[model samples]
Target: MAALITRTRARWFAVAAAAVTLPRAAALTARASALTRRSMLLGAGTGALAAATSAAPALARPAPSDGAWAKHDGAFAGVEFDGFKKTPSGLEYKVFEEGYGVKPTAGQGIKAHYAGYLLDGAKFDSSYDRRSPLGFAVGTGRVIKGWDEALLDMRVGEKRVLKIPAALAYGKRGVGPIPADSTLVFFVELVAITG
Candidate 1:
């Protein structure tokens, strides 16, 4: 009788110990799995939803080709203008009105009223709508690379149509109103060299 009770108590203690340890072990495993899943999501670029609002995504896109530049709608859509000039860095622009006003250099304060568009003639943003000119320091990394390069070449009051490649404009991740891997166009007018 004594031996039977001792065996029963030992068995119960073992089962209880297993029950307690099992849950802790399972909880630890779940935590580890959740951490690994989160890391994998970040590495794969399907980043955390909260982070996506602030973080610029990795450049998963390649340098742009001429396909996006195919005009979907515009008066000059089908017209191949000979005046389109290319910069060595692949920015394309055609001058509409070359003003005699001041041209900006590096670190110069400049202002412009511009309409931004995607290649499909979708307007994304415009300072013109707000009745205000956009102002920024030229060549100071304050703006996108395409904008900085364009601003440097532009004189105040000059108007031009710009075809900015994805790499120069937004890379793989575009900001608000712009889509990922997009090529952009702009009908930009240099309002003034603020400096």
Candidate 2:
């Protein structure tokens, strides 16, 4: 009787182990199958179909080259102003109010108040409407690429106007109210850095 009980316990343990291992083995097999299929498709010159079927976000439009900003003639066309600076990534900004405090680094949470508009002066979004500041991590792509690049240089209490090209803002597929390939203007006030 004692030997029978021990055998039963060992069998139950083995069964439980197999149950856990089987699912993981199945998942790995499925992943391998998908990769093999993708490889075959690529070799067959069906790269586009393979990419479309893959789990990557489709780029709505190609990003403009960094030098493309020089030739850009959009809403900000012919507008000249002093103190405006351009980043290497083509983001442009002018500080209106400078604040004194520690500047936020990448991955730090920041609170900011902002009103976003199209170049034609149509307001599309505002934190003021929600009666609260927008909060996001600085330089971590939590917001748009432009915001991530611009916020890094800002100090607490700083107010600035950002002229974001379409690629940095939303690419070709604009958000609800904003139109595709639209240039955006944002009046931003940094409220706090709360890492």
Candidate 3:
């Protein structure tokens, strides 16, 4: 009877030890799997960030083309006419209607209505469409070089047509709807000198 009880107690202790050890081993395995999943996710996130930065180009102004002058001259040929006078900086203009009101000075503000077009006659922008006139300081670099130079000498109610060279307009890389190396034309009406 004593040998039977000792054998039964030894069997019970072995079964209890196995039950405790099995649960601990399973917990360790689950912890290791969770760590591995976290590492994979972190690595994937870093790779995606690197790929996104490499795929996008840096934001910077494009360099002007060497053939800007040649392109401007070719575009100018289409509108070559008498009475158009060229400024020292290659801006061509013709005042179709003169105004008697005060002309805007360099720092003075002016209101104007304008329509912009490309050399091929495609309209790019216009203040008339929006029923709003543009207002800016004259010769303050608030606008393109051509507008700055022309507006300083313009008076209120004056209407002029400007043929802007590429350098005086949007340069080699033009804005939306205007192609690279394009020359611009504008029919500008000086509505008022606000300042």
RMSD of each: 23.7, 19.5, 29.7
* lDDT (C-alpha) at residue 19 in model 3: 54
Residue 147 local lDDT, model 3? 94
Q: How badly does each model clash, as a count of residue pairs?
A: 0, 0, 0
Instruction: State how far residue 20 of model 3 sits from its true place (Å).
Output: 99
For residues 100-141, could you state the per-residue lDDT of candidate 2 as single tens digits? Answer: 667899999998888787877677787766767888888888
Give residue 141's lDDT in candidate 1 (0 to 100).
Answer: 96
Number of the predicted model whose lDDT against the real structure is largest: 2
Could you give candidate 1's per-residue lDDT for residues 1-195 as a string of tens digits?
999999999998877666555455445334323433212222332233224322322211111111222223442342333456899998888764445545888998887777787866687787776767788898999988988898899876566678888999999997998988887877777777778
Candidate 2 runs further than 4 Å off: 1-83
Compose the digit string of candidate 3's lDDT tens values, residues 3-61. 99999999988776665554554453333233321222224333443343333233211
**Model 1 TM-score relative to the real fold:** 0.59
